[model samples]
Target: MGHDHAHGAGGNRRRLGVALAIIAVVLVAEVVGAAVSGSLALLADAGHVASDIVGLVVALVASTIALRPATDRHTFGFQRVEVLGALVNGAILVVVAVGVAIEGVRRLLAPEETHVAGLPLLVVAAGGLLANVAALLVLRGGDRQSLNLRGAYLEAMGDLLGSAAAVIAGVVILTTGFAPADAIASLVVAALILPRAAALIRDVVRVLTESAPRDTDVEQIRAHLLDTPGVVAVHDVHVWAITSSAPVFTAHVECDPEVFEEGRTGPLLDELGECLQGHFDVTHSTFQLEPAGHVDRGESSHR
Candidate 1:
């Protein structure tokens, strides 16, 4: 809670600007290269670059909104904006991969005119790889804090990998005069993209569904609280991720009436908060204090 989010937002914005510029330049280069060379690999790499461009633009927009001050309507502010952008980005990558697969399948079914020039595609792929690698480094930490950043990084990395695959495929096509190599590389890129898209979808679902933080155990948290002094029992415990990285929890704590009648719950709550923060790494929490026996013996975790 004490961390200054402004620092992170500023960093993200700076990185986003750099990433967008890199993608734009490489994307333009790809279009020219693909048009001139008429190479399937170049076209595929260009398609991957197009995805990177969108992802970077998304990152830029998300970063700008992420820095906005919280409003009553949006108590969590625009942090979730980054997550939305990430989800969109990941989904777009899936679309791109599928599009590429369709093209590859079409080519496999009915072969078309393709100018396989190893040197031309190689030159374009090398430049693309260099730019995308730099973009990847710029977006690394952004992914750690923001979903938008993760999407952007993945797309950029996909461009890098796709370009590498295209280069190798181009070399083989040029050497052996076999056009299928290009389709093979495109298929491989498509396969690679499916798992990454699936993972991003899973992460987004977990966060939005209020699923438990991956590392925390609800029973373990309940036991920790029940062990605290003056605690009669603990119930209605819940722990879940607000985002991939942030966690929030809520619970109802039963306390000894004798001690509560003495108004000693303040210190207890403070101690409990500290314990959870230190031991469980639960950052945001709310607990409804209950007098012993005020609630039923069994309780369920909710919201």
Candidate 2:
């Protein structure tokens, strides 16, 4: 009646750990550069990097917790902790972006009051860019398969763009003596962060709300089940995700009475399970097979 598929946390903890180390080094460098050069762009980038460190830490801890085996009290185990960790990472990004944007705008309005040392800012930003590039590569391999990894990847990407912007701002200030370029670069960093943060939060909300994965089509699955040879109808079909990689499904499958009478129900169930696993990528599934004449006393209410 049901099948269980094991989904591991993958190599995400190692990826997060490596990314954390790379970003921590960058954060310290950026903070010192921001102080010495008096560059708001560097300062904003430092703050963002600080948040990235926190996000990576949360993701690392969550990925570790997710490996716990299922118990009687928690059938799904702690896999959803990764989603909750991603939510925290997303929230941190939003806060950092808003704060950076506010400070950027104020600095833009008073460019004359800003004093930035171009050469040091440029040197430090270029180094930060390289570090971010390395971090991105480390996190890239698993980002698409895991929400927790994707959250960390997005933050690394934000750092990459922010560092590039700071580099450009430094060049402009060094060549044209335009101090407002630093503020503009900080604004650009904020712009790059917000959309990605929103997307991550949106996905986290979908998982938390028990919504079907974006790529799954419930009607298509119903049609597939109905098209099977012995299946007369399908009802009470439900599909949702425990995490990005873990999907759960359940349905009541009305079958031909002859299928049961002839002892063919086992083969029919096997076919249905294969269809779901092969076509829908739904590894965890439960089917309540019944003859056409079967009646569900009170359970039919929802169906």
Candidate 3:
């Protein structure tokens, strides 16, 4: 297929390291501000920043682990660590968002007194906004096709929005002495976190469960294989992702006996491999060339 795939995550790991540092600094600042001002919105924003810190840390570790070389005992060489990290990040975000939502609702009911020093809150939130923007830009140039990097970027974007919300809520409370505004802002931050967390979790589950690539149609693949000359049937076809960008496939292709007799299996195998790689972005595939009714005879079927 002539596609040159970039295999390592070294550059991405460096970027993630930088982003993690920025998030750690901002998270601490937000926590202190939340405590001093007793601002629900600021506290919620701090929680989001904490999530980003965790997400970035996971991304950095996964990226580093992903660069390890393959060994006989671990043939894939820890690449799947990226997917696992993404899953863990997703789960944590959901839990944290739920906690924020509950706190926000409770504050809305009772209206906690917010001694929001508006100018300081604004300054801190603005600084957080700037930091998150910087982190996002740093991660933007990395291999976002990887789920790990994508998760980091998404978390940073969410933190940026949360910071903006905190700034607006701070100004509102300062001007009107309205305490509910802080709670409302916290609710908004929680809403922003939920959908992205759910989506990330779904994607991670798909990969872990060995579901087919979202864009590849199994029926279409079967038809394409059947279209090849000397092929009689296709069975036990399966396609799945090993990571966000890496897909693995295996199938049993039944062909005429004469094709095997004539030592034509090599050319046929090459043609099938090229077809899969070019059409469906499947570079790793295993095909069992067999005579018709191979499955009926108790040949193993992965499907």
Candidate 4:
């Protein structure tokens, strides 16, 4: 398990490096294109790429931090730090989107003249889009389960859309020297960014606040464990993420007072852990084995 964990971290770190390089290249290209064409769409893409750079840097740092040993000061270690970093990335993404939206609106209000025709715009815009797509493909696997990578991946995804919007706008400007199309396209890119930023913020907020996973119901978990073999009742249940990939659960399990004292509680706790792992993917568990009727049932754990 330890070796596998080390390998995963190493792999993620390597991928993060690659992604960051790609974003750096894209940012420079997009900013130059924005300057040349005076297109808000190009500038908005630069902003998205900026977020990607920050997100990837955060991810790399978090990945390195997570590999550190669990010290007494941090009992659960730095796993959740990754989640916190991701939360910050999410918030930053939303802020970037707002800024981009403002730029788009400004562009809409005062359209800028651009010699938008031909090769320079298309070449840079296509390069940015291709870079974003490559980054997305690089980080694709981990995005589903890892919030840190997801934030980065989402940034890349957002960049892809934003870049494509810029490309379309550039093409339109090239065909007909109408500068308003660039601003309109930037508005469309900002709209795309809005929902993604909101959703990432919500998910990361839930994790940082220790909210239960949406798919796992605390009541249902308690009820299921109560029906397990040799279990008198269950209470004081707590379930939350240690990171995007790791969830921890702690609960007080009421077993028969006599049977639990000696080693009887071990197997029961094992079973409960197994059940939790199977059903909820909770990887760490702490059970406070208690006697029956010890605590009132209604006062279990926090809901």
Give the top-scoring candidate (lDDT).
2
Candidate 2 local lDDT, 24-110, one digit each (tens):
999999999888877666776788889889889999999888878789998888888889989999998899889889988998888
Q: Ranking by lDDT, best first?
A: 2, 3, 1, 4
RMSD of every candidate to native, in Å, equals 2.4, 2.3, 2.8, 2.7
Residue 219's lDDT within candidate 2 is 95
- In candidate 4, list every pair of residues with a backbone clash: none
Clashes of 1: 0
| Residue-level lDDT tens digits of model 3 in 148-262 | 7878877887788778877787788678877677678778888998898898888888999999877789998888888888889988888888788888888889999988899
Considering summed lDDT, which 10 consecutive residues are worst modelled in model 3?
1-10
By lDDT, the better pick of 1 and 4 is: 1
Tens-place lDDT digits, model 1, residues 114-170? 546777887888888798888888888778776667777778777877887877876
Using Cα atoms with residue i matched to residue i, what is each candidate's TM-score against the true structure? 0.91, 0.94, 0.89, 0.89
Cα misplacement distance, residue 11 of candidate 2 (Å): 0.3
Candidate 2 colliding pairs: none
| Top TM-score hit | 2
TM-score of 4: 0.89
Q: Between 2 and 3, whose TM-score is larger?
A: 2
